[model samples]
Target: MSEGPLYPPPGAPTPEEPAAGPPAQPAHPAYPAPGTTPPPAGWAPYPGAAGGPRPGLALGAAHKPGAFALRPLGLGDMYDGAFRIIRFNPKATVGAAVLVTAAAMVLPLLVTAVLSFTVGLALDESGEIETSASTSEVLAFLAAYGSLLLSLVLAQIGITLVTGMIVHVTRAAAVGRRLSLGEAWAATRGNRWRLIGLVTFLYVAFVVVLVVYVLLWVLVVALADGPWPVVVWGLVSVPAYLALTCWMWVRVYYLAVPALMIESAGVFGAIGRGWVLTRRAFWRTFGIALLTVVIANVAGSMLGFPFSLVGQLATVFTPEYALLALVLTQAVVSVVQNAFTAPFTGAVASMQYLDLRMRKEAYDVELLREAGIISE
Candidate 1:
């Protein structure tokens, strides 16, 4: 009946690990011989399981009494277990997403403003605009707007990196290690440029796909002079974009920042290393993220509902309230949407980071041993 701080609650433990400890050393009359089958459902020599020996020590658990047990949380197990995490560990998921989204909101505004002003200043002084209405002035406008656009894209990519770091922290935190935004930020300090390059590469690839799509649509429009071909093109394009969306996500999302933060991988090394880790685990990664997104969207809807109702009423009845209504809607969307959803994105990223590291490093097991959750 006791599920202490470390002891898993019901549904947490697998059926094998008894509520009580394992048998004593002398309780065993016989040990298995080499090259022979061990016990049914073989037990890994977990360092700190009940009746288990410490590190480098071996222990066996009996299953149906015939075959050796497989390792806990191997790839197949992790794939199956990911949803269990989303159901049980949602707090970690959102906590991670929010940190990243908040950074996106705060940092980009400052970055865009500063970069825009610098470009405007350059246009006045050196871009060779004879007057404010000149082409250089026009370029200045583009620069300012482009800065904003670039800022948004950059924020998205940075959030991905943040996702990786948060994942790293969550994995550690699950094992009773303390973690914080400051620690995650410190881990990201020098890695920003390489991460940016990775983001840029993926962005360019998407842009090229989009451009090709646009051209094909334009050609279709010119030739058919009817809407049906255009409609067909649009239909085909949806899955094209979906595939690419999943591509950049899987290839580069966890690769850059998580690899660096958790595995201490270098910039280029992180890319190759990430691919290696993610190649077969795409759906597991996607499922954990997809669940986070769904929960965040639901929570965001709950948060936004009130504001949306007020906004609708404001604009419908009050003609003079137009400006006020518009601003209010914007405020409502930001306050509600970001507040509820950002953290969820960060947390999902965080959990994914933990799963990756646990598979690669078994740090969780070591951590369990150190925390006395498992025996030495």
Candidate 2:
């Protein structure tokens, strides 16, 4: 009342002065405090700023502290962010991919080596099967073929696991955090089995679809009165089957792994989540997936060509160690090819998942909050 005390009254806890040093900067300099001076003209507001534009409202305002901006990504953004994720944390992305690929190739390499050697020994100098070939030789070849199939199944399982791991890594990168391989692996603990089950179920469904298609074709052939009917049936059904398969893959299966890993969903739940996310966005999802596949395949083929050429040359020059040389070279090719392709595909899928979530659910707000770029 008297205005005598300009400051705190006696015994009142006075505000402490800041420590003597340069002024502490805001955690996010881009997002200036509310009611403060607005940014200069043409200055885009930081993403998730108070009263700032939401994702679709102003994509230019989106902030990117990690792999991608916290907004719906364009095609270029998706591709660029995929590569950024790989480059940002190679230890978790590419390194993990290489290790998984090598491990997956081990049994396949062994089986191929054994098969080649057995078949080689069974043949005469002219490379014709010997008339005196033993039953064991034939059995060895058969067993090796069976083992090769088993190895392929195991390799697929390994790839599925690594896909989940890459999803985890991408998630961390989105939040501007770098996850180590062990941390990514740890993040996938409970979801690994779910991922495996999801992949297995998809494969089984694919096989069932093929079997049914084949059976229907057989029935068509059996019932047809002429070869013309058979030809007509094939002409109509082949493209339909292929279209259905591609549709299922792009619209239904593409997002399952990200859903499973990010949402901790069950096998079927993740599948349904993917289906839901793709609603009204089929073309976008399909385009992104198709482009990613083409890029990965081209890169993989390019990387594998040199190794393949070397293997062929080694086989031509050193016929005695041809099998071993070819096996080793193929294994190397697999490691190198998958090391690049797997992570790239996984990152693209993850980017798609984030983009979908941001478009549908305003997930950028949550992501920004989690990343500490915005206050809760």
Candidates' C-alpha lDDT: 0.50, 0.72
Top of the candidates by TM-score: 2
Q: For residues 1-376, what per-residue lDDT tens digits would candidate 2 score against the true structure? A: 0000111212235334324554322212265578666544322222222342223222233377456777899988888778877865677788987887778668756876766665653334454445676777666556655655665566667778889988877776675555556666766877788889898899888889999999999899889999999998989999999999988997668999999888877889899989999999998899889999999999999999999999878867777655556567867887888888999999999999989999998878777765555654
- CA-only RMSD, every prediction: 12.4, 12.9
**Consecutive 10-residue window with the lowest summed lDDT within model 1:** 61-70
Stretches of candidate 1 exceeding 4 Å from the true structure: 1-165, 223-237, 254-256, 264-268, 316-321, 360-376
Residue 167 CA displacement from its true place in model 2, Å: 0.7
At residue 151, candidate 1 shows an lDDT of 45
**Relative to the unseen true structure, what is the Cα RMSD of model 2?**
12.9
Superposed Cα RMSD, model 1: 12.4
Query: What is the Cα-based TM-score of model 1?
Result: 0.54
